[model samples]
Every structure is written in structure tokens, then in C-alpha cells.
Target chain A: MEAAPPESAAPITPVLVAEHLERKLPGDPPVTLVTDIDLAIEPGKFTAIVGPSGCGKSSLLYLLGLIDRPTDGRLLLEGRDMMPLSGDERAQIRLRHFGFVFQFHFLLPEFTALDNVMMPIRRLGRLSLPGARERASDLLTSMGLGDKLHKPPDHLSGGERQRVAIARAMANNPLLVLGDEPTGNLDSTNSARVVELFRELAHEQGRAVVCVTHDPGIAEVADIRVSMLDGRICEVLRQT
Target chain B: MFPRLGLLLHIAAMHLLVRRRQTLVATSGVAVGVGFFLAVSALMVGSQTDFVKTLIAAAPHIIISDELRSPSPQPGVREYGKTGAVELHGYKVRNEVRGIKDWQQILREIDAMPGAIGSPSLSGAVTLRQGGRDEPLGVVGIDPTIETRVSTISEKLRAGRLIDLERVQGGVIIGEDLAERLGLGMGDIVAATSARGVSRSLRIVGLFKKGQSGLGSGTGYMLLREAQSLLGRPFVINRLGVKLPDPYTADAVAKQLEARHGYKAESWQERSADFLGLLLTRNVIMYTVVSAILLVASFGIYTAVSNSVTDKRRDIAIMRSMGFSQGDLQFVFVVEGMALAVAGVIAGWLFGFALMTVLGSLEFPIQGEVRHLPLDRSTRQYLIAAAASLFAGIFAAWLPARKTALVDPVDILRGAV
Candidate 1:
């Protein structure tokens, strides 16, 4: 059992750090996405990257999530160099320590809510069948989806499907959770609920949470607000 | 066991279930292919097996005749290569016995060998006269007891017993067609004139029906003693028939026996070479049809999987993000094809068995009795059909599965933010 963090919330070792990260798409005229980014993601903090559509905020989030490779920078996971790892190795790392929630629920339409949550745990192979099932059921129950555990994504409402996606993201107990407009398609109430869930996932569970979104709700509530313009972070504000 | 096999199968099953219509069409295509392959192959191969068995049972596995495989070279050809300016036209050959002199001893030797029986027969062309009508025919003289062990002639007897040739003195057995053509009946006497110009009266003792037109209309059989007296060929047998337990070994046995006896030993297979050639041609045609069916069936699976991959692009991206490897995705899709193929095999077996049963129950008219269609319903046919169906299904799905692996989650998910 872990004791709750004190009110002071003393600084601790960062879980991920990006040092001057950059990515360029190769072509006759190479297109540059993100440039000169220096950021550290501390545990127990919800960080939101907010910008215009072409500001490369999602690109930066992708780089941090290990889902995309940086063209010219060093990335460290818990201070260990991630620059030399292969794509497959990066995917493994993502599977083991990072969970992602996209704007669309993106649940495999053929699988039930419980199966969607169980997919990651089953892939990690750390738990047996019954154990994985139990974990998914318990997580869905906690998310108020116990009644809809066996329903497919199409059978659920927008809000319920998004909750299932969130539950899926946290199924593996990942150290970091990354989302790209996780509540973009949800109603206002659902968006607010999703924001509170991300906040809880970070503050209560002690995990780093990062979101790239145009939604002002997430921007207003995030613990750390990162504002970017034309592929560069122009502002970083921390709440007291 | 495969790693994460249960999860992979679950995912594959879910995808297939979601696209039930496409799956059914694909599976039914394979099932129809398998059913046709099994049913047609069984019928064709079955008929071929029936024909070969009939040929085998009709006569001895090997026939040792009083003849030379290669006649001795002429003196002129041996000495001068036929170009010495001395054209030898007139021929005078050495005088020797007309038949095998020690046939009884050869028969005894063959009988001593394991799983072999040898029977002797004397055959020649003769003219028969019945009430002013004269018909030239071929006749064979056989011992009643030894003939039964080597040939199927005893089974063809329709009227009189084979041993009646010995029971009724001066008796002969002739085909029913030949007897009818001569207007002769059992116990009637006919004059038999041998090629040697000797004549004798023979009583009709037996009537048989043969499948061959030539044999049924112009052949006769008699006791060996009577043929010897009538043909003026005493105590000499011209042919020895050897039967073996395994007909397939006839060629080797024939070669060895011919080498030892300095006679022309013809195996049944050698005699049926033309028939076997026809059979081979037919089998090639059958397999080509079967292959075409499977190829078409494979196209159905390929189309189904390719369409599924296109329709489920979003699911593929999410699964990749969830840590499922590309190889894992490919395996799942290919196993989807294998699942359909297995189901097809099961369904195909039922359909094929019903087809064979229906065919086997049908009767065709032959001579005076009924004969059902021959069917080779061996277990091996099912195994071979299943193996082929599965292999074709796997190969067909493999290309689409590879395409599934190349799916770019980044491209598909770029708009999420």
C-alpha cells in the first residue's frame, strides 16, 4: 500500500524527458513538424499541450509516447537513453509502460468492453485468463461500466465508449497515460468526466498524464499547461 | 502452444463473426470445392481400381508360353549382317517338339514356391461341324482341378460343370454364344477337326459366357486327354499359367521365371499396358479439374480477407497501438482462413459421402445380373482432400494477411488529435 502524497507535493524524479526533440518528413522539400522541444513529465501531474491545429502539439505528444521516432534529439525514459532502441523495442516499451487514448473510442468493434480492456493485459502476458478477466471486469465496474461489460462499442453511448477506452488505457497499470483529444466526440458532461478521470489517474494513482487537445476544458484543468505556436512551445505554466 | 494464442484466436473469431456474410460465402466456396474434388476423385479412381482388379482376376498374373522372347538370329544375319550379297530367301527350320516337353515338372516347381499356383493348358485352332454347318474356332484343353486355381473360367460357366469334361467321356465345353450359333445343346455330339487334319466326335459338356466378344463367340474347352488325342499332340502342354498372391509383383516374378525357363512370360500388367495408359490420361484430366476448383475457392477466401482488412482499418490501428505485433496480426488473419477451411472440410466430407452412397446404390445393366458402381471410399481420400483444402486456403489468405501487417496506424490515427 502507498500513502497519499502530502499537500506539499515535493518534486520527484521525472518519468520522461525530451531534450530538443525534432521530427522531419523526408521529401523534395522536407517538412519539419516539431522543433526545439525541451520537456520533462513528472509523475502525479496532468499535462496538456494546447495549440492551433498545425502547431505540432500532437507530434510532440507522439514523440513523448514512443509511438514516433525523433529525427534529431535524445529521449530518455527515467533517464535511460531511448534513442538507440528499435521500433519493435519502442513498441514493447509503449505496451509495458505507456497507454494511449485517442479521440475516437477506437475499440475493436467486434469485441465487448471487457475484452477491449483485457487486450493490453493479455498482450503483456503477465496475467492468466481468469485474472485478466477479473481485472478488466473490476476496472469497468469502477468506471460505472459493470452493466455494459459485455456490450460492444456500437451498443454503448458516446460517453460509455469513451469510458471504456479510458479503462483500456489504464488496464496495464502503465506509468504514463497519453491521450489525443480523448473526449473530442463526447458531450460537455462526458468531456468533464473524462478530464476528471485523467486528473485522478495522475494525482491519485501517481502516473504521468499527457494530452494533446484543442479542447479548452482540458487546458483549463491541466496541472501543467503547455502552449505551442508554429512547432515550438511558447509557454509552460504550473498551477500552485 | 503458440504464445498469446487464445487472445489471437478470440480476436480472429470476433472479426469473422462480425463479417458473417462474407465468411459464409468464403466457407461455402471451399466446401463446394472440397465436395466436388472428393466425389469426383473417388468415382474416377474407383472405376480405375475396379477395371484393374477385373483385369487381374480374369487370367493368371503371369503366363509362361512355349515361345521365345527374342527369336534366335538367322544364320545369314548373324554371320554377314544381311548384306553379304547372298540373299537367303528360302527358309528351312530345325524340327523340334510343338509344346513344352516338361510342363508337369515346371508346374510342380512353380507350385512349390510360396503363394503361387501354376496350371497347364494346350490351345489350338480347330474346325467344328454340326449338322452340315462348319465353323472354324479356337479351343483350349485344361485340367479341371488345376484350372480352377489359376483362372476365372470356372466362374464363367453358366450351364454345365467344369468337371463334366472328365465325367462325360469325349466331352467338350464351349461358349454359349458359340454353342447357340452352332445350334447345339448339352449331350449333342459334334465333329472337331484339328489343324493336323485329324477328326473326332466330342459331346457338349459345358456352356459358358465370356465378356470378350471374340472368346464368347469362337472358343471351346475340353479335357486335356481328349485334346491330345484329337490334335495328335500327346502328353504336351503349350502354356503354363502362374498365379501369385500379390498381382503387383507379377512383373518381377515374370522376369525371373522367363529368365529361368527360356520362355516368354507375359505379366498381366504388361498385357494391359494400353488400358493403363488410358487410365493415366484420365487421372491427369481429373486432377486438373480438381486443381481448378480449389483455385477458384481460394480466390473467394482471398477476396473475403482483403475486404475485411479494408473494412477494419481502424481496429487494426488500435490493436497495433495496444501492442499486437504485425506478425501476430498476420497469424490471426491466416488462421481465420484455416478455420474456414476446416469447416469446409467437415461439410465437404458429409456431402461427398452422400454423393458416393447415391452413386454406389445405382445399378447398371450388364449381361443378365445387376452391378453397382465401384467406389474407392478409402480414408486417405478424405485426408488428402482436407490437406489440399487447408493448404490452398492458407496460401490464399497469406497475401491479404501480409497487407494487414503493413497497415500504418499513424496514417489511420493521424486525425484523432
Candidate 2:
């Protein structure tokens, strides 16, 4: 716990970094999704990678999140090289230190909200049944979803489902939270609430968050914004 | 491992429950196939065993027939009539059989064979007169002390006492069906004519009814010496009743007797080959058809699993991206199929047992030497069917389960992404 940055620290060692990355789509006419890109995300920073359609913003985020491999690049997380680890080792890293919230909030339809949140912990195989349940309840309570513990995805509204997804991503106390258009499927009010939750998590909990979005309003609220175009990082801006 | 197993089981159960209709359709496919297999196999085995046991109870395991001589050959024709090769010339037809001069010697030789148990019996067509009515019947001479070794008729005595060895003068047991037809009762005296035209009055000491080969109904049993005396032969027998130590050993013993001695010995199975062959063939055909039922039911399982894969495409991709392996998904579907198969086998077994019980109580129609229906061996047949049903169900689900398990998670996700 002491290894984590304090809330008072304005900046610390960058937890995620990608340098000179390139990804090519193998097609009749090959398309380069990312090319010679360099980026870094500092701890406790609410950063958004924004770009137009067909830009490499999502690809760069996916590489930083350790969900996909870069064609020719170096990726480092917490000062450790991400390329030498096996797929299972990478998955363990994701399960332990990183949480992901996808565009669709892919909640298992058959499981209730509490069970969905408990899935990652259970998969870790380190906790007993009651221990996992307790952790799941605590996380849901922290996320202000205690009342919807037993509601299935279909029964829950889109906003509640997204909250459940967020709770699930944070179940293992991950250091970095990665969201890819998490509010893309929600309405304006729900989207604002989701962004507020992200801001609170980063500012109060002292956690790093990197979100990929095309929405300008979301980018405007971020402490740091990286704009990408044509598979290259065009500019980086900081809020005063 | 245990925790993973628990999680997998919970996940499988939830999926099955959520897709209740699909699960039911899959389970019912296996159950109905197994049910028909069990029912048909049980009935076939039961009927076949019943037929064989009933026939054995009424007859000996082995039968010996006296030799029959051919007519004298015509002059200037090199024609010899033999067992397999009979040459015919222009000669008058005549049959003159040599009497068994050394009857005691032959009986002793037959008894000396390994596992051979024999009793002398004399048979001939005779007219029996009782209460001013006459009926033609086949007369049999049996040694009372050893009669039970070959035939089960003694245990089926419905009225009066069985034949007594001490009463050597003359004692007879007549079938109940024959007794009824002749208006004869126990202890009634009936005059029986022998082949030599000699007549003797015999007491009906017992009456019996046989389920199969109702030769019991139209048969008369008397003392061996009495039959020989009535036929004007001092010591002669028309046939001998022979039984081996075990019913399955009859053929071996028969082969030995034929090789050692120049006498033709026939096992009961050979004597009733036509009937036994018919039953065995019917059983094979029926079992084949019932097993094929499962072959058809597997198609339903294939369709159900294929549909499930199609419906759960997105879920599969998410699971794969979350680190679930292909082997894991394989295990999931296997668990589903195994659950369905187990339920089907259990249900089919219970249903088969119930059917057997009902069949055991009901009377079947009489046909071609068989009167009673048998459900005694149904349990064993049901067990065989249950095993076959399970095997077929598992095999049927294999192809579909593999297809679903191996579908590229990345491809599925990319198509829908």
C-alpha cells in the first residue's frame, strides 16, 4: 500500500509507457493502425486519448492496457518490460494491477451484479467463497451499488450495469483503470455520472486512469489530454 | 482445482437453467432414445430366455434315437444307403431296424462319458382308453429315481403323488391337459396299448402342465421295465434321456459320445434348432433397430448444441478475452452433455423397470408352442441398454461440443466488434 503514490503528490513515476509503436493490418492493401508512436501515463493522472475514427488512439490504449501486442515497440508497466512475459503472465498482471471497462460493459447476462463483480476475485483463486463474497459486497458498496447486488444485467438499467462493470474492474484493487468509451452506450446524464465516477476514482483514490474516447466533453474534463491522428500522437495538453 | 471445478459447475448449471428449453430438448432426446432401447432389449432377452428355459424344462438336454435300417438293395446296382449319401435303385421300399441286443452295454457306455447323466426312456404311439373314451398319446417310460435329473415335470405335479420307485409293477403320470381331454383323474386306471399289441392298465399317479412344448399335455409316463415288457422286449428302450453337468456343456458331451461310440447323440439345442434360431434372429434384429434409435436422437443433440454456440457468441468472446482457455469451454459443454446423459440413463432405467413389472403381471397370447410370457431376465437387459444409451449420448454430443469449443474466440469477436 505504501508503494502507491499519496494523494498530495502532483506527479510520480509514469506507470504505463509505450514507445515508437507500429501495428499493420494484413490486407490486400496493408493499412497501418499505429506507427512510430510514443506516449506515457503518470500515476494519479486522469488522461484521455482522443482521436477521430480510424486513428490509432484505441490501438495505443489497447497496447498500454496489455490487451494486444505492438508490431514493433517497447511497452513498460510499473518499470517492468511487458514483452517478455507469457500470455498467462500478462493476464495475471491484468487481473492484479489493471482493470478494464469496455465500450459495451459486457456483463454476463446469466449472473447478477454481485456475482459479476466477484468473478475476477474468484478467478484469482486466492480467496475462499465467503472471503470473495465479502470483498464483492465491499466493492459494490463503495461504488454505491449496494442496493442492486442481486439484480441481473437485464433487470438493471444501462447506467447500473455500467456501474457494475466498473465495480468488477476495480474488484482486485487494480492500480490502473482502463476504459474504452465506457459511456458510449449511455445517455448524456448517465455518461456524465460515469465520468464523475472516473474523476473521483483518480483524484481521491490516487489511481491512474487512461480512457479512450472521441467525445470532446470527456476530453475537456481530463487532467491530461493526448490527441492522435493518422497513427501518430499529434499533441499533448495539460490542464492548469 | 476444486475451486475451479466449483466455479465451472456453477457456471454450467446457470447456463443450463437459463436455457431451460434447450436443455430439456437435449435431455429428452437422450431419454426417449434410451427408453426405447431399454424396453426393446428387455423384451427380447426376456422372451428368448423364457423360450429356452421352458423348452429345457419340458425336454432333456440330449436325446438318443434308435437306428433305422434301409430296404434291401436291388441286384446289379451298386447302391448303398448311408447317413449323408443314400443311393436309390429300383427296389421295393422296406425298413427293418435291428433290435438293441446289448441295451445294458450301451446305457453303461453313455453313462461313463464325462459329465453325462442319463436315464433310459422308451417311447411309442399308443391308444389309451379311459371312461369309455379313447385317445392316441405318446407313451414314455421313465426311471422314477432319476427322472428329475433330465426333466422338471416331477416338480410340476398338479394333483396326486409323483411316480414312486418302490411301486415297480406299473405307475404312470399323465398331463393335466391330456387327463382333461380323456375325462381321467388322479388314481384313475386307464388301459394303454403298446406297439406290440399288448395292453396294460396304468394308474394316473400324477398330472402336470408345461408352459412350452405342451408335449407334457399329450404324454404318458410309465415304468421302464413295464414299458419293455408291454412291448414284448425283455430289455429294450426307444430313447434315452441324457443331461450334462451344465446345460452349456451339452454339445461337447454329445460330440464325445458320437466320437467314442458309433451312436448318434443330439443335443436338445440341435433338436429344436428351428425354434431357437427364430428367437435368436428376432432378438438380433430388434436390438439393432432399438440401438439405431439413439443414432437418430444424437442429431437432436447436435442441433441443440450448435444453436447454443450461435446464441452465446459474444459471451464466448468475452470469456476468451478474460483468459478462459479453449479447454475450459470444452469442459463446460462436456459437463452439460454428461448431465443430460446421466439424467436420461437414470430415467430410462426406471421406466424400463416399471414396464417390466407391468409385463410380468399381464398374460400374453399363446403362439406356436409358447404360452407364458417371461419378464425374469428383463433387469439384466435393462442394464445393458442403459450402458449403451449413455455411450451413444456421449458420442453424439462429441462433434457439436468440439465445434463449439474450438470456434476462434478472436474471429467471433472481430466479426461482431
Candidate 3:
């Protein structure tokens, strides 16, 4: 697989930062999901978090994506403290600045690919219906899914479905894109194609991309890799 | 805002479409409830209005009687009021002539009241004797011109005009059935004796038919002056029949009259209180039964929504991760429920209208007359049915919508994928 190119000459600015984050589920003996996690995600870089099963890779990704709250930490989005925000405020921030993809495409089966991509655009309510439709079409076409926009998720193949989900995640022009094993369900060729697309999304569009994966191929293509062991980050690898 | 709302509606419609069978079942449940509610309410309200119309047409809105509900003190007792409270042995109550003294002045006062037209009348018991056959009858004395304004007696005349009684002195209007029973006709003279034994021969000038057996066979009308002379009670009126522009205000008007004037004024509604009370009770029972149907339909909605929520758990988690708020999820489901209710309401209205039209076209015997079934096509009944169905659907969907809104997307995602 061809590795992603190094960062351009433009100075890097961090889009998301986490300091001393800790997540513990309430129990007789609290189950710690992640601990002492400190990270900064810069724009125009593709980062991969790799770990064995149950080693907090997905948990750390969820925390970074703002989908899960940490028990003790300060998370800053674009240098603004996100901990004091209300649930609705956090949702608004997610709508404007963050996008997510899961291992399962998670596209609503009842909606056409175009509608699924338009979901975030319509939810943000910044675009008219025609505008949203146009934007969704553009994104799908960019993902090489022009002909399949009107098809339902069930009608599409696995790679097509994941690509549709990616187009949906980028619908609102979010600053950061987070994926949890997005290519885990794809074959080798489709997984390599998805990783190439992620690298292009980060380098060409100047957006931060963070993905959690066990696939060594995905980590090899990423510009930076963070490995986790027993709920803690154990190693950081950067490819020049 | 419009785009967001459209998206929510789109999603809600899509969810419902995914489970078309359950949607149909729930919608039909509400439809049936609303349909029955409209049909039954229209029938009951229609019959009530029809009965009231007949009652209003049959009699005056208010009747002021000269006789007091309680006995008046004797002149001697009034003159020696409370003098040592003397108790008399063998005291007996004697029946005296009952008539309104100074009734012309009272009539003038009543006529001056707003929206009121009062006519003096004297009703007494008499017997008609013709061909050696005697039948007991009620003799009503009325002024031809004033009585026509207060009662529908003029419209009921079968042979001659009520005004014809004025042209012929000592002329009376008898019901067609009464005239037939007595073997008498217009221009025929019949011997009549008052309860006081005063006897006279009166000519039948007009015949009236009211479609009621008792009224047709036992009542007669004559000139007020002639009836007073024959009954040995000249210059006396025992009753005042009153008509108003709006008959529904009769009770309030009657109360006002009774308070101002000491005569016992009774409204038509007051006279028929027992029947009206029965009608009201029937209405209560009908609403209870129909509301139970809606309640059952609401349970159908509840189950349908609950099932949808369970099936859409993964989709819900996905939407939440896509940045949809809790209110958005709740709004989508609630919109689904409201859509079903609205569709059902429309269907029910059409169903009820069709039923009413069919029923109204059929003829049935009612009180010896063939008529169409009463079915009120009032918009109020439609609104009530719609409002009830909507309320039930929303209430039923509330629990499931709340549950769906409170769903933890992480929990669902962890288990689902």
C-alpha cells in the first residue's frame, strides 16, 4: 500500500486536544475504559489508533469524537473547553465541527444513499432542500458513487455502503472526522481504497482524520500512529 | 426550520412505511373509534333537537299561571294576622275559583318585557253533548289575533281560519278527531256544559288536526270573552301564554318574570325536565362508551409505537451519532402518531357523513308520522371526534417516544454492532 504524503509546509494547528482523560464505568470495582490519555490532533494529518481487543482503542476514539464523556479530563475543541457545555450545546458543536463513521456503515436502510448523506446537512438547517440535495450529490459523486445516489443502503455493496457513510459524515464540512474500524468489514482492496480516501480527506481538504483500527495496513498508511495497551497509550509512531 | 421539520417528517413517514401493517392497524383502530363517536353523537344530538323543536312548536315557551304553587291566606286570616294564633277545630280547605285578578294589567307588563308576547287565556274542563253522547273536553279560551302570535294554533287549522271564529259569535274551533267523535262538522251547533253547570250551544267554526291523539280528541278553542261568560267567570284570565324571539332563553326569562311578577311562570324546559334529564343521561353514557373505544385504539397505537422503537434501536443510535438531538427523535415519533391520528380523523369524518346521509334518506314511523331518521350534521361533532382521536394517539405514543428519546446511543451501538 502507498503511504500517505507528509504534511505540507503550512504550519500545523491543533483542532482537538485531550489532557489526562479518564473514563470509568460505575460498578463495585469501577471498570476503567481509558486512563491518562493526553493527545492533540492537528489539521491536515491522518492519525491511527491501534491496539489489541479490549485495550481502549475504541473507547479513546469515542472520547475524542465527543460521543462519550470522560470521568476526569478537560477536552478542548478548537481551544474552547467542551466539558462545561450542555448536552444540546455539545450536539450543536458535533453537528458543526465533528463527523463519525463506525465499523458497520450504519446508514439508515430505509433511506436512499442521497438522503442518508443529506441527513446531517438537513439537520444543521443551514441549507435549503435543494442546497442540501446538491451538496449530498456532490459528496457522493466525489466518493465515486454518482450512479448509486438514489439506491437504498441494502441495494449497495459493502464498500459502497461505507463510502456512502463517509460522504454523510462529511456532509456538514466538519473540521474533524473520526472513524471506529470503518474498513473492518471490507475486503483487502476496499479497505485499501477507504484508507487512501481518508488520507486524501486529511491532506487535500485540510481536515483532521482520526481512526481506530486493528488493520496494520491502515496504520501503515496513516501519518501518525498511537498504540494502546491496557487502557493506556504505550507507543507513538510517526512516518515521515 | 422548514428543512429540519421536513427531514423529521420524512424520517417519520419512512419509519411508518417500514411497518405498514402495524401502521394500518393502528390507524384503523383510531378511525373506527372516531367513526362511531361521530355517528352516535350525530344521532343523539339530532334527535334531541328534533324533539325540542316539536315541543317548542306544540306549546308556548313560557306559561304564567294565576294559581299560586302555595296557597294564599284567606281575606279574614289576612285581616287578623297573627292574632293569638287561634286554632280552630273542624277546619277544612275549600276549593275556590282560580283566575288572575287584574290580568289585563299583568298582560300589559309582560308585553312590555323584551322579546316577549303574552296572550291571556282561560282553560277549564267541560263536557260536549251531541246526539245524546257526552265526552269530557278541555276548553281553552284565547284571543284569535294574540294567540296566533304566541302559539302554532293557526298553522294547525284543518278546515277554517282561526280568525273565522271572530266573524261568527259563539263560534269555537274543535279538533278534527273531536268533531268526528261528536258527529259534528263545521257550522254545526253542539251543546256544551261548563264544570259550574252553565250550559250553552256553541257552533264549530274551524277544525284543527295536531297529529296527537290526546290533543286531537280532547281540546277545543273559543273566543276569550265567550268562554269567560259561559264558564261563569267573566273578566278573569287564568293563564298567560308567552312567546319569545329566542326560545332558548325561556328559562332565564321565566325566572325574571317570576321574580318581578309574583305569578308562577314555568318554561317549557322546566315543564319537560324529566325527559331532558333522560336525554342528558343518554349523552353521558354514549360519550363514555365511545371514549372507551378510543382508549382501546390508543393502546393499539402504544403497542405499534413500542414495536417500532424496538425495531429501530440501531437506527436511533446511528441518528444520535449523526448529531440528532433527543428532541429530534421524540419529534419524529410523535409526528408519526399525529399523522396516523389525523388520517384516521379524516376517514372517520367521511365515514360518519356517509352514514348520516344514508340514515337521513330512510323513512321510519315516529309518533304516527313517517319521517327520516334524525342525524345532525353539525361541525361540532366532527371537531370533537377529531380532537378525541388526536389526544388518544398522542397520549399513547408519549410513553414510547419518551423511551426512544432517552435511549443511550452508546449502549445501543455497543450491543448492536
lDDT scores in order: 0.86, 0.74, 0.87
Model 3 C-alpha lDDT per residue in residues A69-111, reported as the tens digit of each score? 9999989887889999877787888888988988999999999
Per-model DockQ: 0.53, 0.28, 0.68
When candidate 1 is compared with the true two-chain complex, its DockQ is 0.53
lDDT of 3: 0.87
How would the candidate models be sorted by TM-score, starting from the highest? Answer: 1, 3, 2
Pick by TM-score: which candidate is best? 1
Report RMSD (Å) for each prediction in the order shown: 3.6, 6.0, 3.9
For candidate 1, the per-residue lDDT at B230 reads 80
lDDT, candidate 2, equals 0.74
TM-score of 1: 0.94
Against the true structure, candidate 2 reaches a TM-score of 0.80
Superposed Cα deviation of residue A236, candidate 3 (Å): 1.9
Error of 3 at B112 (Å): 2.7
Superposition error at B375 for model 2 (Å): 2.1
State the lDDT at A173 in candidate 1: 96
Worst lDDT run of 10 residues, candidate 2 chain A, spans: A1-10
Compute each candidate's TM-score over C-alphas. 0.94, 0.80, 0.92
Q: Name the best candidate (by lDDT).
A: 3
